[model samples]
Target: MTPERREEPGRRKALAFTVLVHAGLIAALFLGVQWKRSQPDVVEVELWSSRPTPAMQPAPPPPPPEPEVKPEPKPEPKVEPPPPATPEIAIKEDKKKPEPKKPEPKPEPKPEPKKPEPKPEPKKPEPKPEAKTQPAPDFSEMLKRESSERTARTNAASAQQLANAARAESELRAAADKKGMQDYAAKIRGKVRGNIVLPQSIQGNPEAVFEVIQLPSGEVLSVTLKRSSGNPGLDAAIERAILKSSPLPKPDNPALYQRTLEIRYRPFEE
Candidate 1:
């Protein structure tokens, strides 16, 4: 059979199946025509295309910076050694010169004692006036009393003289008398006389006294007082009169002569 063109339904079916198959295979083998229809559009970026550009070209990382080493602080400038201390000069001990001993203090002079002021002498007491004394009454009464005593004394002496002279020879008696006479003349000195000063109150008293000085030859010397004047003037005159009458008669016996020669002057009872 050449296959007479006949139409079988099955075969048509078979033919349709074959055509669909071939067409499906042809559609799957498309030549780059992308026929995309109704799926939503989607965009996808590649990772390598979106990288950012750097602002500066980075240097390869430098070797790690060296760690800063701090240098130790320099030691403070060394202090210069102080100049060697000057050695204390040991001066040789000077021989101890002893200080001269202080001069001994001069002793102060003693102050002169002050003189005492002269005190006024007390005035002497004036003498008081003395009361007058009364003169003796009746000068002759005193004279007579004194004369009586005198005369008796003379008489006794006269007796003694006679007795003593009686034993001597006449030549011896004469020689003694002459010797006494010679002494009597020599007793007077200085002008013609000497006067015995008697108090005026006693001019009238007849009490008598005599001076009988012995010569070198032991002879009785002289006598002259007498009683003749009544006035004091005349009585005073009589005292002078006696000294002026130097020599007088001599006695034979020396004892009688010496004992009696104090011639008493009776000047008050004329």
Candidate 2:
């Protein structure tokens, strides 16, 4: 059949469905209006009283009248009929056209045969030179030389170790002797310093140097002034203090004893 004739049936079905929907809407609106009008009106009231006082007796003569209310009629709900069933129209589909046939692929050419590779020539081996025969070494002579060399090295190392030990011993002894002498001199100075009486005329700080001779028993033999303090009175005081300090402290080590000693003194030695 023609396409125009096929479309005519679909159009008629659409028109019928639209008319039925309009009729349903109108019926719903009319029912809603009627229900609102039939509903009863409500009234609310509130009562208030003053503060309570003492109870008073009175004559019972009046009664409260009853309130008169009119009865309201209930609205009857309208029943809605079920909507008509929609008609399902049969849709006619057009036939599909046949697809064109694809062209066949051509066969690939066969690969050429591979040629055989030529082989390399084998190399000739060269003649080896004859080895010369050597005489065997004398193991006894070699061992004798090695033993002598080891003995010489051991002797040299021993001598060096002994020399180093001797040198270290001497250095330690010298240091101890020096320390003993310094402590002895300090003790002597302490004694002399305590006996010294400063002269009133001695103004600035002055340094004096004195050379003292002592016996091994620590007895002062004599005292000679090497550098003066530039003041005669101060010099006399220092000399008297030194003389009073006779029999000074002796050295702890006898090797640290000296016949003559150079003593330096400052008036204000902090």
Candidate 3:
């Protein structure tokens, strides 16, 4: 079938074209009427429908696929043989044969330890709790009390010893009177009281520390020097000092003193 052509479209030109085509058609119709007197009959035209064209064909199918192939198997790994054992040998000798010796392994050296030197055995210290709640007590008062008690005990003992010494002195005086040395001792005492003192280092006499006895009426008897102080000068000086204090001071102890006097001066008395 033939394709329909598109009309050139525009408003002002189509309107002018339509007006011209109508005028021409009207003039042609007038001419046709005039020509109709000279001619015969005229015919009309009719339009019919048209058929469409056939469709195009497609391409043919491709060839078939090829077959697949399988791969070959792999070979196995090989193994090694074990070592042969040593054979035993026979000997025909009188002497014994030695066996093979095995090698000895060297020992590893031991490490020197940085030991803490036993850390002084860690002196098992006291518990922390006991150290905390329980505080140390003051011993000052207790020490002072003990000191006072000790001093009091020492003073009492010293007083008792002094009393004992006084009693002993009394007994000694009585004994001297019985032995008739009291008056002599008294006169010697008066003479020695302030006049003489023995050497400080003198030693060795408890008795017979006397020399001569002089009566109160003024008579010098045999003078004996005993218990020498190991020093002739001191002994002589003591004698001189004693003689210089002669006619001994009268004794205030009347019962202990007498008319007959014994003079005694020992450089080593005490």
Candidate 4:
């Protein structure tokens, strides 16, 4: 079947479903609007009376009008009569007659004069004991001396500490150099020993020592047979092996490099 014919049934189904949904929505809206229109309006009322209520009656007719008050009249003050006036009496002074005057007696003679009193002797003041005074101490000079001594002690302690630290550092450096030299020698010996080929004539375990001279780059300049293993073939084999290891292994620390090295090797010894 063609594509358009296949889609026609689905399209018709969708259209029918949409129509049903719209009709349902419309019916619901219509019912809601009708219900609102049919509902009756509610009324609110407040009950009241035209005349005053018992709780609101006029206030007891103003408490029956207070009684009127009247003031009483005061009595009049009484009057008193004055006492009768006393009569005036006059007093008279008496006059005396003059008598003859009498004469005063003559003055008596004065007594002899008294001798003058002697003046008291003057007193001598006592001398007070003297107090001995001590001289004041020189505090500034004492303080300066103490401060100088303290500073000297501090300087000496600092110097001692510095010397101790320097000595310890030197010892540590020497130990490290020694270890580096040993490691460098060991590596060279191992390389040379690996290249040695033993002869069948070799009877017992033999040891050979070779003195090698090298440059800073580890290039061998010369190899001298310092000691032999007693066997001629073994000695020759050890020399050839030393020559084969021309350029030796270098030290890890450059400061440990040496121009001459004494390497000892054994064929069967570990």
Candidate 5:
């Protein structure tokens, strides 16, 4: 019995060791499955699209297509129907001749009468009447007073002639001055017109006014636009033109020369 008991104890110990080993293996396998379930799964995928996003450096938007310029269509010429031909008609008329009248005779010239010779007159007797005044009226004094009166009349006539001559001279000078002023103004206008370069798109007679200052030598000192023509380009062009005409036309008469000029610029005919 002691021998059997010892064998039984050894078998039980072996079986117990085998059972503990199998239980440890089962515990390790369950922990590995739990760890695997807790861990996160990582997946990688690639995305593609036909169009590029802003984020992606989109190729510089194909250079914006250049705008095409079309030639302006030319206007067709108008055709007018010719007038119908007119038929010619001929007409004949007869002319009448008148008879001539007789001419009248001219009167004859009469002869002039001659003057008669003078006859001698009878001699008459002279009467001696010596009626001498107490004092011969002062004849010398009378002659002197008459001479003074004549001198005064001659002086007055001379004064009147001088006044008439002065008035005529003044009138002639004024007329000449006015003509000179007109001519000077015309010359200035012409000079400005010659230098002006009009814009192609301008329409209507839009006016641009300027106040200009100049030197006596016809040099343009300054040009200030007083009014605009509404078209900035046109106004700018004219302003440039005025400056380009640096030395303007000088007046024929220096007295007609002016320092300032108010010029009105018109695009069309002056």
Candidate 6:
């Protein structure tokens, strides 16, 4: 069958459904309209006139009260004290008060008198020609002495520089010797330190100084305590350590070895 014919049933069903829905909506609208109609409508109308209306008048005020009648106050009885008998003793006229004396005007001081002018003395005639002017002294010798002094100062400065150079050289040599001695002393210290054995009772940093006599072969011949530490045990321990460390390490240079060495031992110095 054709498409229109085949859709006829569906179209009819849709139309019928739409009609039923429209009818139901219309019925509901009609019922709502009837209900609104049933309820009475309120109409409000306001009329305006071009001319103004008259205002209301207020009531009038009450009348005033009648005048009051007051009785006159009785006159107070006169109780005058007998007028004091006119002060029988005569009143002397008031003594005239003395007028204050006006201060006298101060006299102006007179100006100081002018001093008399002094007469000038007459000048005496100039002295006649006398001795002739002295001749200027020569400065050549002074100049020569100054030159000599300058030359001497230069020479002295040169000599001082040479002396300073010599002293510097000596100081350098001494410093080198001191450094070598320090190294040798450090080596001996290390050796002795290794041999030292401190007691547990020893506390604080007690220092012991020893005068060590040694041979060039690095043998410690004698150990003499020069300064003893506060603790006798520490001092003894240091002496023993020095002796035990005989044949200590030798310096690189044999000449650096000293016959007597002052050694300061401190157990706390690590």
Q: Give the per-residue lDDT digits (tens) of candidate 1, residues 1-270.
A: 435456566788999999999988888778446665432211111111011112012211211211111121111111222110000000000100110111111111111111111111111111111112234354644465466556555655664555445434444644554455335433422112233333445434442223434444434455432222235554454445444444433334442233223333343323
Candidate 3 has what TM-score?
Answer: 0.24
**Model 5, poorest ten-residue lDDT window?**
86-95
lDDT of 2 by residue, 19-106 (tens): 8898888998887557443311211100000000110111011111101110211111112111000000000000000000000111
lDDT of each: 0.32, 0.46, 0.36, 0.47, 0.48, 0.48
RMSD to true structure for each model, in Å: 91.3, 67.3, 79.0, 67.1, 43.3, 57.7
Query: What TM-score quantifies how close candidate 5 is to the native fold?
Result: 0.44
Residue range 1-270, candidate 5, lDDT tens digits: 889887997889989999999999999889766734331111111011101122123223221211111121111111211100000000000000000000010111111011111100100111111123325455644564466556555545554555555556555655565466567666666666666666677777676666578899878899886557778888887778778877878878885555766566677653
Per-residue CA lDDT of model 3 for 177-226, tens digit only, reads 33443344444454554565444444453222234455653344434453
**TM-score leader:** 2
Off by over 4 Å in 5: 1-148
How would you encode candidate 4's per-residue C-alpha lDDT over 33-139 as one tens digit per residue?
A: 67343312211111111011221222133222211100110110011111000000000000000000000100110110111111111101101111121233346
User: Between prediction 1 and prediction 4, which has the larger lDDT?
Assistant: 4
Comparing 2 with 5 on lDDT, the higher-scoring candidate is 5
Where is the poorest 10-residue window by lDDT in model 3? 46-55
State residue 236's C-alpha deviation in candidate 2, in Å. 1.5
lDDT of 6 by residue, 26-80 (tens): 9999976773323111111111110011100110111111011012111111122
Model 6: residues >4 Å from true position, as ranges?
A: 1-165
TM-score per candidate, chains pooled: 0.18, 0.45, 0.24, 0.44, 0.44, 0.38
What range of 10 consecutive residues in model 1 has the weakest lDDT sum?
84-93
**By summed lDDT, which 10 consecutive residues of candidate 4 come out lowest?**
86-95
The list of candidate 1 runs beyond 4 A from truth reads 1-169, 185-226, 240-257, 262-270
**lDDT (0-100) at residue 234 of candidate 3?**
60
Candidate closer to the true structure by lDDT (higher is better), 2 or 6: 6
Better of 3 and 4 by lDDT: 4
